[model samples]
Target: MAETQKEILVRYLQSAREALLWKLDGLGEYDVRRPITPTGTNLLGLVKHVASVELGYFVSCFGRELPVPLPWLEDDAEINADMWATPDESREDIVGLYHLSWEASGRTFDELELESEGEVPWWRPGQRTVTLQQLLVHMIAETNRHAGHADIVRETIDGAAGLRAGVSNLPDEGFDWPSYVDRVESAARTFRASDG
Candidate 1:
């Protein structure tokens, strides 16, 4: 049977989620939690942030309370609290919350028609209203964007880059990446000024 629109949306959303999570696999705790970018992006933190936003969009925006407690999202929480896992927050804790968010989001998907309308509390007054379909697309984009970040962060950590396990989706396995980088850099250098 042909797949439904909802199924297609869910499939893409799940794919992005899996890709983001896979970036953390086989890494030690410090590696997963440590900020990779100067702006402080990390693997476990991305998972936590995604999970928090998922619950907000799928659950709370639809007139339902969050199924899990996210103290990081509370009014008094520190700025960017959702962007990094604290030392006390175990890898399992963040990943577990993300798993729970999948369940909560799944229920929302199962219970609501794509046209069902909801309000985003944090959005501007006139623009807070949205349909489930719009939110699905928005979330797919959101998750995939962060998944891309995870791809770079993971690569920086240990040179692992791919859509998922056993699927590099890159050039030939033995391709010379160093030579490729040199050629690209040399091309850019052709436009450089002669000044020291």
Candidate 2:
């Protein structure tokens, strides 16, 4: 049977989710949680952020009860509290919450029609209302954006880069990355003196 629109959206969203999680594979506790960017983006933190946001979109925004309360999102919590894990929060804690969120979101996907309307309380007044379809696309884009961040952060951590495990979606086995980078750099350098 042909997949429905919801199924298609779910597929893309799941792919991005997997890619983001893949970045944390085979890494130590410190590596997964440490900030790789000036803005403090980290692999596991990406997982946490996405999980929390996904819950907000799929569960809370639709008037569905959250599987569990997210303490970090409370008003009194520190800024960006959802973006990193505390020492007390183990890797399993974050990953477990992510998985639980997936289950809750999957239920949302199963029960809601694409055109079902819901209001995003956090959005601007005029734009607060959204349909399941819109939120699905929004989340797919958002997840992929974070997955791209995870890719660069993972590459910087240990020179690992790919779409996912066993599927690089990059150049061939014998491709020379260093030479390619040098060539690309040389081309850009040619414009250095031309700029006024």
Candidate 3:
């Protein structure tokens, strides 16, 4: 059976979301919150920012009202609140909120036609309208880019690698662990030497 364009788009969006969330699997709150880059991009913060942008584009832009008020948007003083998780926000709370945002965004996408258009209030007044298709593509690109960051961040944090939980298909138990590490370390040293 041929997959519809909508199905493909939804699948890609969901895949990206899963990859981003997978980055947090088997990690502690402190590790997830620790800033990985000079820009302070932590795992939880990336998840939070993705959730905020997804809600804005898929729900707010489509005129769907948010179920709960976002104090960050209401209070102009803390404009950057959407970009980072606050101290009061726990790992579970932030993850749950992100899942909720995903559900809301998915619902809006499901109900609206690809041709349907809406205005982004934050955009310049006269040029605010965009089609649902455009937003979906934009979001897929945005989410995938962040998912890549999550992959690198996760690897740096705990040596956890790969896009999804089982995407990297390795043997179940017969593999030798020390040999794997030696090979990886040798490759790293060779690359560094070549660069120097």
Candidate 4:
């Protein structure tokens, strides 16, 4: 049996969404909100950013309104405000908002055909127009890119790395943890020496 185009797109989109959310497991509020990178990328912030993107592309772009207020996403908010969780914003709040966002986006997906057209107000006027198919593909790519970022952020915090929990997402190497670290370090040193 052949899966429909919408089914395929939805599968990929859901995979990315779950992967992003899973990165928050087994962590405290500090870990979820800690600024792992210089740019202030955190687990909660990633979820918030994805939620905002979903609202803009899936709901707002289709002549609909976002169901909730996102101050960081508003026009007058500070730049990059979506990239970090605020002091007053708890982990639960951001996660709940993301879940609600998923519900709103899912409705949009169900109600619109692939050929349905919409506009992205934030984009350059000429290029703002998009179809449901285009937004689906664009968002899949965007979410997957951020999932990669989440993967690295998780690894940095606690050495957790994989596509998902149950799968053997990496090559089955016989090397122990210490040797793996040494092998990687040696490769970096070798490359540095070659560059000298």
Candidate 5:
């Protein structure tokens, strides 16, 4: 059976969401909240940022009001709340809010046709209008890029490497773990010696 354009977009968006969520798997509050970079890229913060962006594009951009008022907004202030999570924000709360945002966004996406246009009031006048399809593509790409960062951050936290939960399905089951580490260390030393 041929899938509709909406189906494909939804699938991709869902995949990216799953990948992002997967990064939080088997991780504790300390790990999820720990800043991995100078910019404070934490798992919970990433989830919160995505939720804010998705709500803006899929809901607010389409003239659909958000259920809750955005906390970062202030009088005559252009605070970009989507950049990071606040200290008081708990891991569960952010993740739950993100899931809710996904549902709200998904509902909007499902109801709108690919050609249905909406004006982003925040954008330049002529460039404000966009189709649901465009937003879907943009969100998918944006989410995946963050997911890549999540993958690296998660791996660095605990040596857990893979696209999703569990060990990656590698065919090299016969390889010894200790020997693999030794070989990698040997290669590093050899490279350093060559440089010196």
Candidate 6:
């Protein structure tokens, strides 16, 4: 049977969400919280960031607000609050908040049609207005982009790489990691030589 547009979009959105969350699996709290990059991108924090984005784009845009306090969205809040969880905030706290936000956003998807009207006040004038469909696509793009970041960050942490667990989205084809790295590095050196 043919699926509805909303169903298709929801499936993709959930897949990206799952991919981001999977990066945190089998890791300790400290590992999940620890900053893996100079930019301080951590597994738990990525979950936090996406939760905030989901609420903002889905609930807040539709002239509604999540019934929760998000101080990070405030003008006076410290920088990067949305990007990293503080010591006081437990891993479960942020992850639960994210799932709750998903529920609220999912409700929005259920209650409104794709063409339902919404406003993005932060966007520059003349482009604030948007439809539910547009927001859905926007989130898929944003979340998947972050999922890719999560993938690389996860790989950097423990060599776990894929679209999700048990799914090898990469082409290994029996090539070893060291051999693959050598080939890739040699190609880069060749390119550099050709440029110079």
Per-residue lDDT tens digits for candidate 2, residues 1-196, read 9998899999999999999899999999999999989999999889999999999999999999999999999999999999999999999999999999899999999999999999899999999999999999999999999999999999999999999989999998889999999999999999999985
Report model 4's TM-score to 2 decimal places: 0.92
Q: Which number leads on lDDT? A: 2
lDDT of 5 at 106: 79
Candidate 1 per-residue lDDT, tens place, 1-196, comes to 9999999999999999999999989999999999999999999999999999999999999998888788999999998999999989999999999999999999999999999999998999998999999999999999999999999999999999888998989996899999999999999888787543
Per-candidate TM equals: 0.96, 0.97, 0.82, 0.92, 0.82, 0.95
Better of 4 and 5 by TM-score: 4
lDDT of model 5, residue 21: 85
lDDT of 6 by residue, 1-196 (tens): 9989999999999999999998888888888888989889988888899999899999999988786989998989888889888989998899898899889998999999999989998999999999999999999999999889888888888888888878978886675878889999988997896788
lDDT of each: 0.94, 0.94, 0.84, 0.90, 0.82, 0.90
Q: After superposing candidate 6, which stretches have Cα over 4 Å from the reference?
A: 172-174, 193-196
Candidate 2 deviant stretches above 4 angstroms? 194-196
Query: What is the TM-score of candidate 2?
Result: 0.97
Residue 194 lDDT in candidate 4: 70
Residue 9 Cα positional deviation in candidate 5, in Å, after optimal superposition? 0.8
Evaluate candidate 3 by giving its C-alpha RMSD to the native, one decimal.
3.6
Flag the better candidate by TM-score, 2 or 3: 2
- Which 10 consecutive positions of candidate 4 have the poorest summed lDDT? 166-175
- List pairs with backbone clashes in candidate 1: none
Model 4 per-residue lDDT at 138: 95
Displacement of the residue 55 alpha carbon in candidate 6, Å = 0.3
What value does the lDDT take at residue 30 in candidate 3? 86
